[model samples]
Target: MTGGVRDKDRDAARDDTLRRFLLPIGAVIGLAIVVFGTAFLYDKNGAENLLAGIYQLLGNNAGATALRNGGGDQFVAKLVLAAMALLVGVGGVWLLYTGVSAVVGLLSLRKQQRIIPWVFVLPAITLLGIYLVYPTIATIYQSFTHGNNGAALANPLANYATLGTQDFPHVILNNVIWLVVATSGSVGLGLLIAGLVDRVKREALAKTFIFLPLAISLVGASVIWQFVYAYRPPGAPQYGLFNAIYTAAGGQPLDWVHTQPINTYLLIVIMVWLQTGFSMVILSAAIKGVSTEVVEAARLDGANERQLFFRVIVPMIKGSIITVATTVAIAVLKIFDIVYVMTGGRSGTDVIANRMYDEVFQFNQPGIGAALAVILLIAVLPVMYINLRNLRHQGVGA
Candidate 1:
């Protein structure tokens, strides 16, 4: 009789605990549903980024300092819309903050107080808002402006008017060609070096030599390569490496940075030289991380060295290879220092970043620059997505 009474008491306690858990879970689910539905409605109208709002505020003129003539409807509508967005923008942020706070409390229940997690997270949150979020919002606002000089930005498609011209497509193709040829070549060489030095007795020494270029800042690397490609009109004692080689071969030293398509390739050489070391180091580390037991077992079999490397090693470190490749690709995509230092976006070496720089700094066109920056970000997004997916897969496997 006593044992039966104890069993009944335990069952009642379990039921009460389950009931308590379900109530909070249900409330959380309801809150999630509401938040998601609101987000869907807001995101549908291409309402992302602050540029559109700033454009609306400026009445379709870039930095006119006033609404364009007869742009009141646009302004009034935007101002009204801004007023409406307040509930979503500000209120949503507050709700998110509250939700995160509650989650922190839940997670830190074992600790002294739930507020400790917030204290730890506060620095990160502050940095994100200031460095990451604020800059992103500011960049968007800059996009709606006409120029740095605060000229009235009228919507004659001045930023995108380049699409109608031939050179615009050429700029795009030049950038594409750079991404493909330069990035692929660099990564390929890096892989070759990494594989060659993976098990070498002087692995550290090899890595140090390969990674030497990474120590140089982008500007410093560019300056060094500028000297390598430096031309002295064929009779200036052949100070540059290329010129010296040319003179040594009984040929006139060519002005490499001034030459057309050749200058593009020359700049590419600098990028490759600088980045090859980085790729080699990362890929070498990945290669070393391969299971030694598996490698030894493969060696004990009748597998030749070639078969062992490609058949066993490559497959295992495929994710690392891809990570390094895509990382180099993104680096090549954002390249500006070399072209900027060497030719200043001239001589047919205008990649997207350099072109964006030209648009904003030289041409004084902010909208076009913003558009270019947005496009660059879009271009790099795929590689970033691939990297994230690869990392998640690795984490799950581990």
Candidate 2:
């Protein structure tokens, strides 16, 4: 009789725990369902009204088609709408977190503690699978298919075979040139600048000016440099800065974009200019983190400034340097804006990304574009693997 009474008490405890957990969850879910159902029933015109407002603000009535694409006129309205949307989004997110936390807290009684983390992470995992995994698989499937439509190619590997062609060789060569020059040039220049300017008066001012380019959009930077590299006929007034300087020095006005290897180098220079500040800032922080006592010991051991820098400082900050170089290299590999805006991939200045764009859109060869994209992904995988390993090591060491 006593054992039977104990079993009944245990059953009662489990039921109580389950009830406590489910009550809050059921309440929140019920509230959410009612809110969504009401919104769907009442706010049927929300999307249409929002789009109409946007259209009106874009001057659809006046038919300013030319000015509509310019964006300067509609900037204020777009900015206001964007700000309002952002505020609403933030408020919604906060409310969601509060609701989820309250529900989870009430439900996290007894033996359900292990499941709470998975409950919180389930939404993020679902989003990642939907956005990232699905697209990658789809892209890979499209690589071997014919054109934009879902038909098999005559030969399964025909698109891959295009990588061996003459034009693709030039494209690969240009990417390599950019990868080597821009990555090294940017990191080297950034390191030198960082080392020289560390602890100097007005250091923040110098760093800010260097980092100013990072604030500019890539397309904007390309546009700014186009005027610098502009070319005209010799007799025509040389309006381009480079051409003007050349003419002043009694040199012929050369079309920088139409030139072969020189044009490729010039484009790489622009990338280097844009990325150097990034490298400098990262490396400077790493340099400053080096132990001062280690530096003092090295100096006491008769190490000169050059020896200290090369032997001590560089070794200490080697990880940051690698990180900076890899980042710049990836940017070089995927560079499209500079080439697209400045040269349109003309005159043997085509990189893989630019060629992929041309193949996909200009020539309507989606298979070839997908093939190029897969190849780029394959190329980046090893670099990414190395970076991840380094990060893991850093984490463990810390």
Candidate 3:
């Protein structure tokens, strides 16, 4: 009887091991079926046939005929496609990860521990390589080539050479102006608002109102501001808010967006308005994180209010300030939507990104566009590096 019991226990262990291996295999096969099935259903020929079969099953009725003829079948097909996309996006990823992880579990304990992290991380790395790294390398290559055919240029630097002439210098200058003015305006106002609102009775309410514009898309903010800066001929009634206010105050109606050099500054105002809220929220949290004891110590040591703020508070949150400034500086470096929507980069308002877009898409000058893109990338990298270094010093992502 003891011998029989031992044999039965051995059999049970074998069966359990088999089940563990089979389960993951089954899951992978099931997921493959769903993926392929969805692809087939999404195909046009398969979709048409499926719709026809469904209509036939519903019987040859007037309602069925009308529905098929009225594009209801197409609408249904769209819904089916959308559903399949969602399933493949969410469900497919979950299923794949589950299967992959289960398979990894079948290995030795030490091996499993070593490999599981890569199993989870490999997909993200693959995606970044495909989407980001490939495009960057390709852009660099294209920047060295000539013309639409992508032939090797006799002088590889010719595209970059063009940047020194013909409005490009002004464009670069505008970007620099935006980087300085927009970054300073946003960070300065954000720091001020954050400091003031920290003492307010309804702090949340004040922050909400100031931060509201940040929620608006850059394009949407530009559209809203277009009306604010809108202009008609001098004799026509001023519809723009600025013009209306100016006319009321006995000043001449001025076109805010088209008034060169100044118009660029006006565009920068929209960025500052949108970004100040972000800066304010971040700086506010940093201020709150300052130790109350340290603040009290400074006050006790005969530090006045202004000195306490500038010397004590600002120094303590200097990391946060640097982070916000660098972050806003990067945004200003790549600014495009506001300039595009408001002035279409007209009248000396063009920045690097807008000019890149024009060269690549509108003007069919891909080489020049690629060169501009490389320059923009070069300009942004240092700011990003500084921000990352600061974050590291603060023990972020440690």
Candidate 4:
């Protein structure tokens, strides 16, 4: 009787393990079949048919015009079908896994057991794998290849070559100039503005005026600058603000874009103007958080206004100051908007991101673009890591 009972218990344990594994797998496979059948039934005029219309609209650039109409549509349809099959198949698998996990969690709950919500987040995990991880891997892979395997594509290392050359090295330096001039100027000017408006009666009104530029988008700022740089024929009336001023002063109008280094700095000014308000607001809050009692004590100790501000107020608010600086620094590092909108990485203003864009899109060198992207990622990671660490140290927490 004892031997029989032990054998039965062992069999029961095996059954439980089998059930845990098989149900989820079966569920996913079933879901995939259903999804695939449904998609085939619904998508009659699939990717091929869509691409045929797009090709005609695109004019003569279609490489496989002979393969268009029925033939091209057929090929594209097969590709789409394959993709749909894959997604549906994986989704089904995940669905099954989720169902199984859910059942297990429910059973455990009945027995007064614990289940983490992280386990139930299978769907999010699947999406992250698809959208984030897959793209990053693909990008790295393509970046290793020499321009889509070097068949009828632009030079793979063209962008990097351009970037590495003396001329292109200047672009990196130009970006550095932008970072130093724009980020520091914005923050410093913002700090000054915050100090000025710290305790004024009409501080709100003053702040509103200073912060007005923050409302403008990078494109809008560029357009405004464009108008300022606008020129006309010598005999014609000047529509550009700067040109009009030049004519008024008996001087010739300048082509701003043609001017190196200076034009780049001018573009940086627009970013500084827009970003200063953001810096000011954060720093202003930090300033407000400084203890009033400390300021009073400093004054009592015969410290002058400037001494009290520098010696006492600054040290107390260092955390907030660092937060604002790091925020601006990150913004500076990722700044493609101003560069893209204003000059399109032209006239000695091309930065790493713009260079990457030129490589990937214009030159069709996806591999080099990926490499540059990785380089950029490496550059920003340190700054971001420190910033996050400081933020958490300030009691923001993990």
Q: Which has the greatest lDDT?
A: 3
**Model 1 lDDT tens row, 1-398:** 99999999999989767545654564465457447646644754323223345666668654332334323345554554575467556665555555544444445356627576665678579989999788767776666655445475676455666544746677777778778887888888898888888757978897888789888888898889889878887567878998898889999889988988888888888888889998888877887899899999999997888888889988898887887878888888888888788888777777778888887777776777876786787897786687689789889645
lDDT of each: 0.74, 0.79, 0.87, 0.73
Instruction: Give each model's clash number.
Output: 2, 0, 0, 2
Q: Return whichever of 2 and 3 wins on lDDT.
A: 3
lDDT of 2 by residue, 334-360 (tens): 999999988899888889999899988
Q: Is candidate 1 or candidate 3 better by TM-score?
A: 3
lDDT score for candidate 2 against the true structure: 0.79
Q: List the RMSD of every prediction in angstroms.
A: 15.0, 8.1, 4.4, 10.6
lDDT of 4 by residue, 1-398 (tens): 99999999999989777667766566556666656546653766545544565566778435336435456446665676677666566665567555656456436554424444555576689899999889877775655455543443366555456457655577667767877788889988888788879979988898888788889988888888888878787878889888899889998877776577578877888888899999898888888888888888999999997887778877888887777777787777667887888778877888777877877788775666676776666767787688688798998855
Candidate with the greatest TM-score versus the true structure: 3
Q: Candidate 2 clashing pairs?
A: none
Query: Candidate 2, which segments miss by more than 4 Å at Cα?
Result: 1-84, 105-115, 147-150, 293-304, 387-398
TM-score of each: 0.64, 0.77, 0.85, 0.65
- Which candidate order results from sorting by lDDT in descending order? 3, 2, 1, 4
What TM-score number comes out for model 1? 0.64
Clashes of 1: 2
Model 4 residue 377 CA deviation (Å) reads 0.7
